[model samples]
Structures are given as C-alpha cells and as structure tokens.
Target chain A: MVVRRPGGRSARVRAAVHQAVTELVAERGYGKFTVADVAARAGVADTSVYRRWGDLEELTADVVITWLTRTSPVPDTGTLDGDLRTYAANVVREADGPAGPAVLRLVIALAAAGETGARAREQFLAERSRQLRTMLDRARARGEEAPEVADVVDQILAPVYVRSLFGMGPLTGELADDLVDRMLGTPGRGPS
Target chain B: MVVRRPGGRSARVRAAVHQAVTELVAERGYGKFTVADVAARAGVADTSVYRRWGDLEELTADVVITWLTRTSPVPDTGTLDGDLRTYAANVVREADGPAGPAVLRLVIALAAAGETGARAREQFLAERSRQLRTMLDRARARGEEAPEVADVVDQILAPVYVRSLFGMGPLTGELADDLVDRMLGTPGRGPS
Candidate 1:
C-alpha cells in the first residue's frame, strides 16, 4: 500500500474536486449534477473521482466536512462572554459569506437525503457540538458561568443559521452580541 | 372573467393540485418534476394548473402560504407565557408533522432558486411575522409585556426551524416551554 504525502498532488486534487463540487451545488443545487460533472469541472479523470469518493453523496459529504473544518475555528477568548460573542460573530460572518448559502443548502440537502446523508449531518453536528463543548468547558474551568452546550446551540448557532437560511435580514455583529447578552442575562435588554 | 363559486369544483381542483404538489415535493425534493407531472398526480388538467399558477414557482409559493396558513394559528392563552408556550408548541407540532420536512425543503429550494424563490421566502416570512405581531399586539394592549416580533423569530421560531431542519432531536412541548421560559426569563434555569 502506498502512503500519500500531505500537501502534495493528492491534496491539490482533493481541493480542486471539492471546489468543483461546491460550485456545482451552488449553481444547480443538490442532485442536479453528478460525479462526472464534478470530474469535468475539476479537469480530472472521472475514474479518479469515482475511485476516490465512490459516489456523489460521499463526495458531497466530504466537501461539507472539509468546508466546515476549514472555515470555523472555535474562538478562545479569555471570558465566556467574549468567547461566545466572537463565536457567534464568526458564525454570522461565515453564514453570510460567498459559500454560505451553498453550504447551508448542502447541509439541509444532506439531512433530508437518506441514511448516508443523515450520517453526514450527524457527523457535522457532532463536530459542532464538540467545538462548543470545548469553549464552554474552558469557561467553566475558569470559574465562569457558561450556558449548557444545548443552550448555545439553540440560542446562538441555531438562530444565526436559521436567519441565514431564510434571508430574514442582514446578520450583523450587533445581533450576535445581543444573542450572547440574552443568553448570559447581561445588562442588554430586560425581558419586555 | 368567469365567476367561480367557492367550495365547489374550483375548490376541489385546487385542493387536489395542492396535495399533488406537496406529495411531489416530499417524494422528489423539488425541481425534479413538471406541470404535466403535477397535473397527472393531481388528476387535473395541466392547463388548469398553468392558468392558475403560471409556473412552478408561483404554485410552490401558494403551496407554502396555504400550508402555513392551515397549520399555525396564533395562540391566545390570556398570558404572555402561556401564549408563547402554546405558540411554540404549535410550531413544534407542525414542524414535526408529516408535511413538515417537505415544506422545509420546498422553502429552501425556493429561496435558492432565484428571484422568484426569494419572493416566496419573503412572503412566507412576512406572513409569519404578521401572525406573531397579532399575538404581541394583543398582549401589549392587555398591559402585558411582550417581546418584539424579531425576538420571537430569533429566540423561538428560528431554533425550532433550525432544529427541525437539522434533525437534531425530537422537538417536544417541554422543549417549547423551555424555550419560552428562557426567552421570558421566567422561574427556570438562571443564566449560567
């Protein structure tokens, strides 16, 4: 068995294929294109794509995982409030970015797809949960009060994502701060 | 213009066509079928669908509006807490229902399709906001404090929709109540 070197030809091909997949998904939406389309768009051999990814679903999942991993690095501010604000801001920025809508569409499509898509969605969410836990755990260790992982998901992440998904309005930094403030019960706005 | 009676053949045909559109969207996930397909499934003439909706996007928008109007009625339980709880519970129920996923998928598809889809998404969202405003206005008129419609959208509606979209877990009435409690800062878990 041959081992592939990191940051080599394999990496380049993978990046090219993933970019192609994202463009296709954004332009045509899910299931409208195929592995061959990706191959052609990437200027690679169709056999290579087939051999590497096995199917369109697997390839799409890999694209999602890769995209998410590259984009969202959890913030590590010293205070829980700072950390959460930064985290929420990062989320808003990403969701409003160029690739945001495509990735959002991809995630929803994967979740709605059958078993394989469900597994991909699970892996994506589990990774997100793990990231949040790391931030919250760090906050708790420093004797800072932190909301539960689920609370963060519901209050911060979910709302940002839903807003992006539905195009409710511009996802502003102020909105992120407000969410954190509300969750932490800081002196922002009282329950009216 | 020919006069069409309410609750007659016109209504029956509309119901059939709408049901057919929902089923198709549920089964195929959008952009897979055509007017002929819808007409065949709906047991109505293709021309009738064309004359009524003009295109799939218009038909889809109507479907979304019809579904949302039928499913969610603003709840009034004489208190802000009770009203929010019941409203959130109703949302959870609808999102967890048989047609929930279909509608969710359709909305996303519409939003991503183009200008037409964007308009549909806006219409759907505006109607939801109207419903929330009606509830909040009533509460305010009764001298009860009420959250802004945007807050409810972000805190309650967004989380539920995002959860349902991602298949995070079972959306329950308790969860709905918890959301309301968190929003209102009632006698529940403190900020932590």
Candidate 2:
C-alpha cells in the first residue's frame, strides 16, 4: 500500500514526463526512443518513470490522452452551430499548434503499431466521439436537431486533420467555419 | 546519354524496383531501410538502382507517383454525383487495400520528413488536385454545377483518409454516397 498524493510532487513529475514524451515523439517519430530516454529528457530518474508508467507504450498513450483532453475539451456555446464552430476552430488551432504535427504523427503511428497502439487509437476515437455526442445531446435538449456523430467526424474533423497531416493548406478559421456550415446544412458564404 | 525504351527491359526493371520499395516502406515505415535493401528485394544490382534513380528519396517518390496514378485514376461517369460517388468509393477501396495503409503512412511520413519529403508530398497533392480539376472541368462542360476541387477534397477525400488512418469506422459505400450527397446538398436518404 502507498500514500497517494493528489496534486503535489506527483502531478509535477507526471507533467514533466508527458512533456518529455511529447518532445521525443515529435523529434524521433515512434519506436525510435525508449523509456530511459524519456526519463532523462524529463530530468527524472529512470526508476521513477518505470515505477509510474511501466514502459514506453504506456507512457506514450498517457501523454496522448493528456494532450487530447487538455487541448480539445468539448465546447458549449449554447447553439449547435456555435458549438460546432468553436469545436472546429479549436481543432484547427490544435492541429496547427507547435506540437500538433508531432502529436498527429504519434497517433497515426500508434494506430499502426499493433494491439496496444490499436487500443490507444480506439480510446482516442471514443473520447472524440463522446465529446461530439455531448454537444449533440445538449443541442437536442434545446430542441435543435443535431447531426449524427459520424457527420461531425466526416465533415469537420477529417478535413482539418487531412490538411494538417499532408500540408495541403493552412487551417484557417474560415475553413473551419465552412466545414461546420457544410455539415449543419447552413448556406455557406460561398467558397473564397 | 541514355537510350529511351518505352516498354522493354528498362520498364521491367523500373517496375520491379518500385514494387520492392513499396513493400519495404509498408513493412518498415519510412527511412528505416536503404537502397541496398530495396535492390536486394527487387533482385537487382545496387548499382542499377543507383544509376537510374540516384538515391532512396528519388526511388520512393517514384513509387508514390506510380502507385497514385495506377490506383486512383479519375472516373468519368458523365454526372457529377456519379463521378464523386465513384471517386469516393475508389478511395475507400484503396485505403482498405493491402498496401493502402502503407502508402498513406508513406505520404504522411514524407510530408513531415524534410525538403525532399515536402516536395514529394506537394507533387502528390498537385497530381491529385489536377485529377479532381479534370473531373470538375468535365462536369462544368456537361452543364452540371460541379463543386470546387477544394470542396471535394474537404468533404470526400479527407473523411475517407481520416477514417482509414485512424480506424474510426468501416468506410462503407453508404458512407461514400452520404458524403457525396452532403457535398452536393442533395437530400440524403437520412442517417442509417
């Protein structure tokens, strides 16, 4: 049995370890670094990392979850259109952020890495779908007809991600809004 | 100076080398293997691959171009809806194909690698955009109001790819038709 600290040294150490993992994944892709590398980069002892996360895969998954939760919290702007627009814009910002490409690559790599990676990918998708469902449920409660979770995924999220992953174009706010409009069947301002 | 042969031993050697590169990249992701590995897999001499393509980067780019051209030819079904439906379905099949995920990974990895990778990624996107433009142009000529190439990219291609990359769900034909319908503002059969 161990005494668990809620938001003290343990929280600081977890934060440091996650940042280290994110940077390493960004620079080296996946499967190229080790837990020891993460420990060293986080400026903590290897034993501490091992004691907490067990291995690199677990540590990497934790980092991805933390990043996703922190950066992409579900929006609640009162209306479905406003909620979707805010959600889409937030995604645009996150994908274009400094660590955006790295995190995207990490997620893609994890999806293809096998069972553990597949599990992480599933968790990420489930979390995203859950957030969208929350927004939709709220809109429905307000008597605003909501689109399926699949529509939000296909229309808004997919394009933003594809553009970012392939460097197709800048992820501007207008693009985000247009996607939301397209999904919601509101007349867009016409293509620029 | 080299003699040009359209479909002779030269073509055969090129095909073999491209196949080897595709398999290697699929199996090991990007930047993990070298020209010699490709040569060995293709049953060709290292000097032969070097003499023709110059380096691994050139060979990889050539493989991507070849794959994209061969797999994703633009369809001319006479109607914009038919054409989009066909195109979207083709993308689904490609993404679900044996080498689909590998090629997708290669393209993403290339985009993030460096200058050479960036150039390759640009070339790939340009080629894709050109194909879409041709289809859209034909639709306009046929008196149909075709959507912008960017619209198709954002609505159809992006979703298919994101679904494939993240394993979000099965990329069904219904999903493809629904996407085309959404883009065209057609009344969908309603969500299934």
Candidate 3:
C-alpha cells in the first residue's frame, strides 16, 4: 500500500482538536467552551487550533455535524420495514447514548437562535434524510408505495425526539418497531 | 355568567406574569431572564410576582403550557383523515408562528437538564397529547380502527418538533397534508 504523509499530520491534528471539542461539549455543554480550552485538552498548540478552525463556532459546527453523522448508520436490510426499524432504533439509541440530550438541546437551541451553527445542523439532518431516501427507494422497488419519503422518514424519527424532549416515554427498540409498522401499515408482521 | 371577584384579580396577575414570561423567554431566551425582569415588564409589583411564581422555572412552565394549549383547536372534521389534516397542519402552523420553535427548544433543553421546568415541559406535552386523544377518539367513534392513540399521536406531532429543532424544511401545510395522508393511507382525498 502507498504510504500517505502530506495530509496525515494536519488530519491527526484536526482529529485531536475535534476530540477535545466533543469532550468539552458533552461535559460542560458548548456555550462557554473556548479554543484555548480545546487546545489544552487536545494537547495541541492553541495557535494551531485557532489557525485551523478560525474560532469556537467553526470548531463547534464540525463537532455537532460529526457526532450527528456518525451516530446513525444507513442500514441496508433489503426491505423498507427492516431498514426503517434499524433506522428508527438507531435514532433512539443515539438519543439514549453518551452524548445525551442536553448537548442536543444546546445544538437545536443555537440553530433556532439563528446562530452560525445553523449550517451544521442543516447539514446533519440533510445527511440523515439522504440515507432515508436510499432506504425508501429500496422499499419502493420491493413494492412498497410511500412516494412521500421525507414525510415518512420524519414520522418515523420525530417521535423519538418529541418523547425524549418531553421526558414522556422510554425510547425502546420496540417503540421503533411500532413506529415503522404504523407508518408502513403492516401491523402485526412477525419479526423477520 | 358567573361573577368572579377575588379569583379574578389573582387570575389577571397570573396571566400578566405568564405573558411577560413568554415574551421574555421568546426575546432573550430562558437562561438569563429573571422574575424581577418579568415583574418589571408586566407592570406588576416585584414582590407580588415573586410570591406568586416562586422562581423563573415555575413561570416558564406555565408559559409553555399556555401557549401550547391555546395554539390548536381539536378538529371534528367528520373523517379521521380530515381531523388529522387539521391537527397536523395546526402543529406545523404553531411551529411557524410566534411562541415558536425557539421557545420550544428552550423548554425542552431546560427539561432535559432536569431543571424544575421539567415538570412544565411534561405538563405541556401531556396537554397536547390529550387533545390528540380526543380527535382520535372521535374518529374511532365514527368507526375508524386505529386504537393506539398515543402511538398514532406521536407519529403525527413528533415530526413537527424534529424538523423544527433541526432547522429542516419549512413546516408547510402541504407537508402536513402529506404526513396525514401517508399516516392514514388515503392518497387522494380532497378536503371534505
């Protein structure tokens, strides 16, 4: 294999800075985190961090986007129901996992305030929605009839956010199955 | 009409305080605004506001509940699909209007943080869910078949919150129609 060198060091530095940012946001929330703090935690030079990211918001945009993008996988279970269950369960699992809802709320609140993080938030959702389209297209080929892919995707995923936010109910894998079944109109299908 | 006396004055004070809280939360957000600030803006005595509200969180809980309760009317449109269209469109319109997604994000963030406002957030969502139950119950009485009201309600309303928080596409009326149609399995129903 060819050895990669030129972009390696810079990529590693970016990774370190991002790790520091993620830890800080998860620990203390993103509102007051500073570039200097990230540099210290990352064990990189503050000047280098600043030079690469420009500022805290730019650093923050990347942190939010990376977390959201990697948290859910684009499942290819070969059918819409299977793919959607995987997809919905992934959304619930992400909501339940370590990053936690507080950080999520902070991101949404910032976007709602029309902050610079809006682009990051928008990019995050768009990527997820793209995966959903792929899943729906596969479903349609299998003779499923939901032409409104985005709308159906939102119905499957939004309940997780709503219930999570309201502290209303547990986000279980079963709930994910129920959601997909309801949307697809295939209730009581045996687990496949 | 029943003539109200002592309770009327107290109700008026509470309403004014809640109005001020809603405005302040919408204007400067939830973290910084105080009881004294609300009292000052509401033209009520600081002592009166403090004694009544106890803290910002109590006032905030009431504000969120009141706005959510009043924003939508339970539909009786003679068909489950029709009622759902009115219901889903109302959820979208509320997100698009004043007392908007920012306030919602703030409330959810507060609740997720395990603040006192968690009770308020819980109360607000419960009220909205209750309304959905009424509409769905009416549909059931008219011989519709979806018995899982809570599940179906979440399917319809949760997407509005998810899309709003993520700063996704506009919560358009057409999107609302698409959501109701997909959920209800009626593709080409005209307004009835």
Q: What are the TM values for chain B, all candidates?
A: 0.85, 0.86, 0.77
Tens-digit lDDT track of model 2 for A1-192: 977777778899998999888878777767778888988998999999999877777777778877877897788989988898888998999998877778888888887887867866777777767878989999999999887887777778889999999888788998887777666653321111
* TM-score of decoy 3: 0.78
Model 2 misplaced stretches (Cα beyond 4 Å): A1-6, A34-37, A43-58, A186-192, B1-6, B33-37, B40-55, B186-192
Q: What is the TM-score of chain A, computed separately for every candidate?
A: 0.83, 0.85, 0.75
CA-lDDT, candidates in order:
0.81, 0.81, 0.70
lDDT tens digits by residue: candidate 1, B33-84: 8989999998988999999999877788889988887787788888877888
- B90-115: candidate 3 lDDT, tens digit per residue: 88998877667856776675666566
Decide which is better by DockQ, 1 or 2.
2
- Candidate 3 residue spans exceeding 4 A from truth: A1-12, A23-37, A50-58, A77-81, A134-152, A186-192, B1-12, B31-37, B50-56, B76-81, B141-147, B186-192
* TM match of model 2 to true structure: 0.87
Determine the iRMS, in angstroms, of model 3. 8.8
Instruction: Give candidate 1 misplaced runs (Cα > 4 Å).
Output: A1-6, A31-59, A186-192, B1-6, B27-40, B45-47, B50-56, B186-192
Query: In DockQ, how does model 1 score against the reference complex?
Result: 0.35
Residue pairs in candidate 1 whose N, alpha carbon or C atoms collide under 3 angstroms? A146-B192
Clashing pairs in 3: none
TM-scores of all predicted structures:
0.86, 0.87, 0.78
- Best by DockQ, which number? 2
CA error at residue B116 for candidate 1, angstroms: 1.6
Residue B95 error for model 1, in Å? 1.3
What does the interface RMSD come to for each candidate? 5.6, 8.1, 8.8
